[model samples]
Target: MKKPIKKQKAVLIILLSNIFIAFLGIGLIIPVMPSFMNIMHLSGSTMGYLVAVFAVAQLLMSPFAGRWVDRYGRKKIIIFGLFLFGVSELIFGVGTNVSVLYISRILGGISAAFIMPGVTAYIADITSVQERAKAMGYISAAISTGFIIGPGIGGFIAEYGVRLPFFFAAAIAFLACFSSIFILKEPLTKEQLAEISAKTKQTNFISDFKRSLNPHYFIAFIIVFVLAFGLSAYETVFSLFSDHKFGFTPKDLAAIITISSIFGVVVQVFMFGKMVDILGEKKMIQLCLIIGAILSVASTVVSNFLGVLLVTCLIFLAFDLLRPALTTFLSKAGGKEQGFVAGMNSAYTSLGNIVGPAMGGILFDVNIHYPYLFAAVILLIGLGITVMWKEKQLAESFAE
Candidate 1:
């Protein structure tokens, strides 16, 4: 049964709030990391490992997490994930050792793996097909808003103590967790979920992945990977690239990134859905790929601060738009398999996140510009793949 409009809006607000808080917690730790490294006597390589491990854990868990979401229930998984997120942040705040921090990150990864698919699947269940794209856009915007605000708040709170931000993050996560237990509703019934689970019964993760390679989903999955890969490559090296190439200060880099994120959020909230409705996902994806490729290459050549800022913002904006466009497409096509498909989408994205930064870092070591150039090349390849893509079977369904 669908929720009443007023009740549905309230539920969506709570769901988006949880998502915002979760990502905000992630952002809250960014500014304090340097102090963390110094206090803990951690090396750069150790920091890299910490970041990589989170993605690794998320990648491994997501397929199973998806299955669990379908078999269990979205509200249950979301509540569990929020509790885990709270615990992870609290552990990270208090822990003194690298091993403890790694444990905390792993839990955080698992929490993310659970929460993302659950929330996405839940949203898919509540909204009619016409509402899905706009709803997905809000999801992306909440995330970007968290990231945009997180560092600033983290930096300010770090005035008291470096660990304070983590504690604050933990507090909010716990608050959200408790609030959700009281407020959130399960959107699907047992029989509905049982049906979904039956439709998606694969023996293992490998089989799940193999099923994703079916013609209906294969192209979209590839686009998800390329989007993650190209965007990760550009972003992971952005600060270093700007600093190295243009002698930009930390404040300068922060301003550029913050401004870009704000712009991306604006577009997501106001324009993304309209664009999707007007142009369709296929066209929007193709256009964003072209934008990503051109702007990525543009970033390498632009020397002035404004020129670089504009190019960088445009590049990120392309990425921000591209992500939801893909998700909206997947949601439309996924039908009863929403949870499973959302899980695989998260998995492919994690796979790209794992590889992209590592490769970008390696290429950055070779030449500062290599990462952007590599991103452009990868995006062009994605664009090529999308050019021949045609959506026939799903087009009629999507039209409704």
Candidate 2:
């Protein structure tokens, strides 16, 4: 019992650190990218592309990332992902032109596609169904915390220059990567890795995706997509929105993001396990989407900073609820295809990121209100799907 507890603690530390670093990299950039666009004299549409480009790379690479996790082992892919993440931030920190920024984002996207799936699969490999949701909640809390603090740090550092935050993000990523190489242990031995890798290589994303389309959790994947899509609209244009509407400073943007993440982190870490136990994943998801949609749409109408912050807090709380619940749902439903399913989960999320910002960007340009309105509509569609989907049947199939 002591041995197992010690082992769980060690693995939890490693997994949580990886997620923190990855999201820290992402969060550090958020408050600064709008300024970057201004520095380059880029349009909202262009900025949207820059933001979505990372997910586009993720969308393209996630399938391969999933297979790589199954093939090469989670440790190798995670380390490589971390290294690439550092490289991407470093490139962005030195970026002078739009082209350089785009290249950097592509690298960042590829890195995310690898890291997200690898870390998720590694967690799934170690934990049991009973404990998986609790584990994911902690991981989600780490991600939210990273994203929260990163922009606060980045915003303060941006007093020097916007690009400096990317450098800072890179430094943290490299440190995390070093830790991974030195201390992280692979749960699977060489023989298990070789066998699993061999078996996974036979199938591609198309087949694997089709295979994942059983009655149980296909809607869950769609929910992930819709949730991300709705959120990225706000994410892609947040700094711009605040700047245009209320003349927000970088610090202000950081404050908003930090506050939001704090709300998310508290729920994900402390309340998530019991909440899911009481509400179940499906009910939790449905309620969150409904309220979140209402909040997303409401955000468009707020003229004051306090109102905006209030709505953002609620919206973020909803997102925090969804992230871990969805992760736990997929993990429980996944069974043996830990790597494959985790990869697909990231793929679906990447797909949302792809569409959300791209569409959000274009819409934000048209009218400040359009993006939020569209997000509300997208989530409403998701809510309907959640309402109509055969939960009892899916649950039964998943158990089988």
TM-score of each: 0.97, 0.88
Name the lDDT of candidate 1.
0.90
- 112: Cα error in model 2, Å: 0.5
- Tell me the tens digit of each residue's lDDT in model 1 across 108-140: 999999889988898888887777888899999
Q: Across residues 26-126, which tens digit of lDDT does each residue of candidate 2 receive?
A: 88887687788888899977776787788789887887888888887889999999999999999989988889989999999999988988898888778
What 10-residue stretch in candidate 1 is worst by lDDT? Answer: 391-400
Model 1 error, position 99 (Å): 1.0
Name the runs in model 1 displaced over 4 angstroms: 1-7, 396-400
Which residue runs of candidate 2 sit more than 4 Å off their true CA positions?
1-7, 34-46, 95-98, 159-163, 198-203, 237-253, 300-303, 365-367, 397-400
As a whole number from 0 to 100, the lDDT of residue 13 in candidate 1 is 91
